[model samples]
Target chain A: MSKTLAIGPFNDAERAALSDEFSPVFLAKPDELAGLTDDQRAAATAVAYKGHHAFGAAQMDLLPNVGIVANFGVGYDAIDVHAAAARSIKVTNTPDVLNDDVADLAVAMLLMQCREMEQASAWARSGNWKSKGEYRLNRKASGGTVGIVGLGRIGREIADRLAAFKMDIHYFARSEKTTPGWQYHGDPVSLARAVDFLVIALVGGKDTENFVSAEVIEALGPRGVVVNISRGSTVDEAALLDALENGKIAGAGLDVFLNEPAIDDRFYKLDNVVIQPHQGSGTVETRAAMAKLQRDNIAAHHAGKALLTPVN
Target chain B: MSKTLAIGPFNDAERAALSDEFSPVFLAKPDELAGLTDDQRAAATAVAYKGHHAFGAAQMDLLPNVGIVANFGVGYDAIDVHAAAARSIKVTNTPDVLNDDVADLAVAMLLMQCREMEQASAWARSGNWKSKGEYRLNRKASGGTVGIVGLGRIGREIADRLAAFKMDIHYFARSEKTTPGWQYHGDPVSLARAVDFLVIALVGGKDTENFVSAEVIEALGPRGVVVNISRGSTVDEAALLDALENGKIAGAGLDVFLNEPAIDDRFYKLDNVVIQPHQGSGTVETRAAMAKLQRDNIAAHHAGKALLTPVN
Candidate 1:
C-alpha cells in the first residue's frame, strides 16, 4: 500500500505538485483526524500547514506514521521541535533563501530612520509647505559605521548590502569570522560603541535572552540607531523604552517586539523611530521561493537524498 | 575715493570675506539708502542679496555709479533683468556650484517616495506595527526608466547618479543634442510616457511656464512619480493637485513650490509625497562652498576678468 501524506492549510499548487508523487490526504480541520481509523492514520508519512499555526508536532500525532514536518518559512519557532524529536519525526526549516529579502528590509529601515524620511513627509502634508524650512540633515550611510549583533547568514547579507553604500562594517560574533571588510568585536557592548547604526540579527535562545540591555543601549550613545530584526526576547523592552524616551539613543527601527500585536503605545508616539510588523521574509517572491525549498527538502528526505538545510 | 558695494542679508562669514575686498556698506533695510548722502550713495559700484527679493532697479538707480548686481544664487528670476539692462547695469548669478547638492536631494526624494519609507514609518509609529506585514516591496531602481526635463548642468548630474542605479535615461529639451546614454524626446508629454520617474530640472520662466501641465501628467500613467528640484513655475499646481488627488500619478517629491513659504495644506495629508522647504543647497558644507563661489565671481568681475557665471 502507498503511504498517505496529510497536507494543508491548503496551498492548491503545492498540494497538486505533491500529489503527483504521493498519495496525499488534505486535512481541512484539526478535529477531522478523530474520524480516521487506526490503520488509515498509521499510513500517513508527512504533513504541511496552509495556515500559520496548523503544522505543529501535536497535530502530527493524529498521523501515527508521520516522519517529517516541513515548514514553509525560515522561522520554525512555532513548531515544537522537541516533541517531534521525541516521536522520531524530523523537522525541517527553510533558511538562506529569504536572506536577501530580509536584508533589503533591514537596510531600508536603517535608511528611513537615519534620514528622517517619515517626519519629512509628515511636514510636507501638514500645510506647512511654504513655511517648512530646511530639515535636519543627518550623516549619510555612505562612509559611515554599521554594526551587526549576530554574524549569521542574514546578518552577513545585511553587511553586504550596506557595503554597497560604502559603510564601514562591524559585527559581534561568538567566534572570529575571517570575512573581508568586517571587523569582529568580542561582545555586543563593544560593537555598539564602535558604530553609529547597530543591527540586531542574533537568534533567540537562552544564551541570547535580553542580550541588548540598558548598558548596551547606553554604550550606543545619543546619536546611535538600533535596528532589531531578531526576536523581541533578545532585547530589554523596558530599557529600550527608557532609552528612547530619554534620548539616550537617537532612534530605532524595530521589526519584532516583546509582545507582538500588543506593542507599547510609546513607540507609536515617537517620531524618531521606524517600526514594522515581523515581516523579515514577508515578500511574495521570497515566501514562494521558501515554500518551494521546503517542499523540495521533504521530497529529497523521503527519497533518501541529502537534505538541503539540516538542523540536527 | 574707493567704490562701495551694498551687501544685503549675507551671513557673518560672507560679510567678513567681502569686507576684506571692498568698502562694504551693509544694507540693513531697503530704505537704508536714506542714511547715505548723495555722494556716498553715488560711489556704490555693485549691490548683492544673499537671499531672494532684493529691491528693484529703481533702487539701483539711486546709486548712479553702480555697474553690476551680483546675486548669491543661480536663480535671478526675482531680479528684474530688463530694468537692470535699461540702466546699463550688468547682472551676474552664481550657478554650477549648487548642481551636485540639489541633484543629490532630487534622487534621495525619488528613492524615499518609491520605497514608501515615510508611510512605513508612520504605520510603525501609529501602534499598528502588524499592519507593516502588508507593505508592498519596492521595485529596484536598476534597469528602470528615468526622464529628465530641462537637460542642463544639474539635470546632467542627476543622470550621472542614475547611472550607478543602472537606469535607462531619457530627456526632454527645447532642442536635441547628441549626448551618449540619453535618448532625447521632443516634448514633455512624450517624456512623461517614456519613463517611470519624471524629474523636473527646467528653469522657471515665461518660455517654460507650466511646462508640466495636465496633459503631460495624464500621459505619465498611474505608476509614475514626479521629482521637482527646479522652480515651482515649471509645473502647473492645479494639474499636479488633480493628478495626485485622482491617483493618476503615484506620488511627487517637491523642493520648490508655486507660492513658497505659503504651501498648500493638501500636500501635507498625502502619504505618497515628500516635501522639503526649498533646501536643495541648504547644507552647511554646500552653502559655504556656494558663498565662496559667489565671492570669487564678484572678485573676477572686479579685476576686469571674465565673470564666472555671467547672466547672458
Candidate 2:
C-alpha cells in the first residue's frame, strides 16, 4: 500500500534502498503498470523509472495518481515528455551526477582511436614487439583541433579536459555559448570542416535524429575522426560505416551505435575504429551516484519538497 | 671516410638529413665502433647516437677524435655523461620536443587501464555486447588522486592535463618544485602511499634504477595502479608483475618494461594491464620533431654554437 511504483531492473542495493525509504511496489518494466492491481496503480504517486524502454501516454494512463516520473539516467529521451506534460505529470532526471564519467569515456575513446592502442596492446601481448622490431608511429592526438557537436553539461566537461590537452576547441550548438576562446560554428557541417576530431554530444531523440548527417561526416575529411558519446540516432551510421570502410574519413570512436549491442558487423573488421559498449556513464562510483540521485528525487517528491533534479 | 659517425638505425628521412648535411658514416650499434679503421676513428669528430645501448668509455675510446655525442632521445642515460665529460666529449640530447606525445600516452594508458576500454571495446567488437547485456562497471579515473613519481617537464604536462580532469595532483621529485597546491612527497614510497594512480616519470640512469622499488609497489596497496612511461630501469618489474599477478595491486599500464621488445611473458597473461610497445614518443609528428632536434644539436656542435640541448 505504498505510494511509489518502481519500474525496470533495479539492482539489489537500489531495490533495498527504494523499499526502505518509500515501501515502493517494484516492477521489471514500465508496461507492468497495466498488470498492477487497481489499488497498487491508484496508490502510486511517484514512479521510480529505469531502463531505456519507452514510457508513453498509454503507460502513464495506468498510474493515474503518479505525479512524477523519476528517471535513472540523465537523458530522458525515451520518456515521452509531451505525454507526461499532457497528463500534468512532472519528470525528474539524474543529470550532472554522471557528467564526469561520460566526459571521461569520450576522451578515452578518442585517445584509444588516435593511439591505435588496441592494436599496440595486442602487439605487445602477442610478443610481436620482439618480432616486429618497433611499432609504426601514429598521428598525435594532443593539441589537435576538436569539434564538439553539442555544448551541454557533458560536452562542456569534455571540452574543458581537452582544452588542457592544448586542443583548439570548435563547437556547434543552436546558439553561441559564452565559453571564451572556443570557436562557435552555426552548423554541424561547418564544425566538422574545422577540425580533425569531431565529437557528438547531442541530446537523444527525433530532433537530433541523423543530426550528424552524411554531409557533416563528409566534411570531416580523410584525416578526421568522429567520437560519438551521444545516442546512435544522432549520427548517420550507414554513412559512417561506408566512410570508415572506404577511407572517406580516417576513423571513428563510437560508444553509441544504431541498434547497438547488435552493432554493425562491419565495425568488427576495422582496425581504425575503437568500439565501446554505450558505457558513457557506466562507472561504479558514477552509477551509484546516479542511483542515489534518482532515489533522492523520488524522496523529495514523497516528502512534498521540490524535486532534486526536475525536468518537465 | 666521414668525420661524423652516425650509430644505430636511422630512418630514411633521418639518414637523408644526416647524409645531406654531415656525410656521416653509419654503424648499426655502439659495439660496431670497434670495427672502424684507425683512420676512420681518428677522423670522426661527431657521433650522431640513437638506440638505448650503453655508450660508455669502451664505446668512446674507439672514436678518439669524437668531440660530441648528439643523442636522438631525451634521456641520455645510455650515454655516460660523466665518462664523456672526462674525455672532453660534449653530449647533447633531444628533449622537450617529445614531452607532449609522452604525456599524452601516459594519460591515455591510465584512462585505458581505469575504464577497461580494451575489454569493453573487445566486447563491443566481438558481438558480446549483444549477448552479454551491459559491460561491467569500472572505476572512475577523473578527479582521483594521482601521484607523479617525478615532476619533470613531461611529468608536469601529464599533471596539467589530469588537473583539468579535476585530479588531485601529488608528486615526488629530487626537491620540492615551485608548483603551487600540488602535493609533493619527499620519497617514492610516501608518494606511492598518497595516491591511487602512480605514474613514473623519473629520468633513467643508475641513480633512478629501481626507483619504483618493491617497497614502493607494496605501499601502493590493492586499489593502486602503476603507470610507467619512463625507462624500465626505473621500476622493479619483477615486483610489479607479482603484484599484478597476485592482485596485491589493482593493475598496471606499462609502456616500457625490462628488456622490452623481449618483455616478460607474464605480462601477456594479465587482463588488468594495458601493455603498450614503449611508444611514448612513438608518434609520426613527435618522432620527426625529435629527429630534427637531434640533427639540430649535431649542427650546433659542428658550428661551435653551444650544443642546442647539451647534457655535458
Candidate 3:
C-alpha cells in the first residue's frame, strides 16, 4: 500500500525523482486516466500540472483522493485555486526563485530598445565597416525615468538594477508605498507621464485587467518606451499598435502577450520594437530551481510541515 | 586685413563661436578652393572637414597655408594624419570625451542581445500581445567573462562598467601590457575563446583589418556573443554571417558598420542579433563636450601650445 502520485510534462529529472518516491501514475492527458484501478486511484496523494494550459475543473475530477496540487512555476494562473480549495486540497506554487532571472531580462529589454543593439549587429554582418559614415545614436538608458506598474518582487528587482544605472525610479501601486528613492504614482496614467521608460510588473488579476490603455500610451508621449514583463492582458493591444504606428510612443519591450505562440504580422515589420517568445522565467538555471522547489514542497507536505509557498 | 580661416562643416555652436575671432571661409569641397589667391589663402590658419567621406591626398593640395585640421569627433581616419603631417600642419582629434557615451552604448547593446529585449518589444507592438506571452529568463551578465578587442580609452570605460556588473574582464592588445583586473590576450581568437562576450573597442587601423574572422567566431562557440563598438572592418562580415546562420555563436550587438545607411536583409531576420545605426557617441552631453574639445584644440594650436590630442 504505497502512496500514489500523478505527474506529466515534468522535466525528465523531476519526473524520474518523483517516481522513485511514490507509486507513480503517469497520465499523458487529463482525459486519459479512465483505465486506472479504483484502489490505486483512491491512494493518490499528489498531482503535478506542468503544461501551459489550464487544468480545467473537469480534470480535477480524475484525482478525487489527491490532497496536493504542486505547480511547477511561479505563474499558477492556469490552476483554479478556488476549486482546489473547495476539496480541502493544498495548492502550491514555486515563487521567489525566478525573481533575479526575470528582473535581469527586464533591464536587458529596456537597454536594447534604448540602444538599438540589433541594427548595429546587422551592419557588422554586412561587411560595410566604414570609418566615416552616417550612424544614428540610439537613446541612452542612464539618467532617465523608469516607471514600474507594479512594485512586487520582480518590479523591486528591476528597480534595484535601474538604480545601478542612476535612473530615477517611480511606481504605480494599488496603494502608496514608502520605498526610498522610489516615487509613488496613483495610477498608470500618472506613471506614464512621470517616466521615460514604463515597465509593467503587476500581477494578472481582475482588478488589473487592461491596465495600460490608449490613454496611458498617449500620456507616455513620443519619447517614452514601455516594457511589459507582466501578463499580456494588462495592456490594450490595439492601443499599443496605434501608438507605435503613429509614433505617439517611442518604442516598447514586451516579454508577455495576451495570446502566445501565435504572433501577428505587424510585429515583423517594425524596426523600432524588440520581440521575444515570452521567456521571463525560461532560463535553465531558473527552471531547474523551480522544479526542485516543487519537489521540496511535496516532500514537506508529506512530512506534515508547513508548505513553502502555500495558497491560503 | 581680416584673419581668413577655412572652415568645413561644423556644428552651429562652433560656427557661431568662431565668427568673433576670424573671417570664416566655408567650402563645399576642399579641392574647389585650389585656385584661391596665395594672399587670400595665407590667412587660412585652420580648415575643418565634416563630411562622411575621407579626404585623401588629392584634397590636401587645396589647403596650402592651413595650420591645423581640427576634427569634430574622436575618429580622424577621414583626414589622413600622414598627409597633414607631411605639410607641417597639425592634426587634432576630440577623444576621451566620447568614451563614456560609447561605452554606455556598448553595454546597452550587449544586454539587449543577451536578454532578447527587442523581440519582447515587438510582441507588445503587434496586436497579438497574447501570442508573445511572458518573459523567459535567458542569461545573466553578472559573473560572466567580458573580452575586449582593444584596450584604448573607450575599452577601459567598458571594463569599468563590466566591473560594476561583476564580470571578469579580459582584453586583446597589439602589445602585452598589465592592467588591474584585466588579463591581456595577444590575438583575437584566444580572446574570443576565453570570453562569454567579446567587445570590439579597437581603433580602425591597418593592424586591425579583419581581426575577427570565421576562426574567431568559431572559437566563441554557441554560448558566446560578440559586441562590436569599433569599426566594421575589424570583423570578417562573411565569416560572421556564416557563423550566425550556422549557430556557431550565440548572438551579436554592433554599433559601427562597413557601409553607411545600408544593412543586409539576413541580419534583419535573425532573432539573436541586436543592431543600431552606428551611434556610439550620439548623446547630447557627449557631443557638446566633443565640440568644445575641438575648439580648445584649435585655440591651443593658435597659441603655439601643445595640442590636446595631436597626431604624431
Arranged by DockQ with the best first, the candidates are: 2, 3, 1
Residue range B184-207, candidate 3, lDDT tens digits: 899888998999899999887566
TM-score of each model, paired residue for residue: 0.72, 0.97, 0.76
C-alpha lDDT of residue A170 in model 2: 98
Model 2 gets an lDDT of 0.90
Q: Candidate 1 falls in which docking quality class?
A: acceptable
- Candidate 2 chain A: worst-modelled 10 consecutive residues by lDDT: A257-266
- Docking class for candidate 3: acceptable
Q: What is the iRMSD of the candidate numbered 1? A: 4.0
Model 2 lDDT per residue over A35-55, tens place: 879998898899999878899
Error of 3 at A99 (Å): 3.1
Task: Give lDDT tens digits, candidate 3, residues A227-272.
Answer: 8888777888888878887899989877776656665557557777
For all candidates listed, what's the TM-score of chain B alone? 0.89, 0.98, 0.89
Model 1 lDDT per residue over B1-312, tens place = 446565566666678877887757787555677778888788777676565554567677787887777877777776778888888877788787777667766777876676565665555555555553345544443346989998898888777766545578999988986677588999889999999899999876666789999899988889889999998888988899888988999999888887766777677667677787776765555667667777766677678788777784
Reference contacts reproduced by model 3: 0.44
Interface RMSD, all candidates in order, equals: 4.0, 0.8, 4.6
> Candidate 1, residue A78: CA error in Å?
4.5
lDDT of 3 at A96: 83
Report the number of the highest-DockQ candidate: 2
Candidate 2, residue B309: CA error in Å?
Answer: 0.3
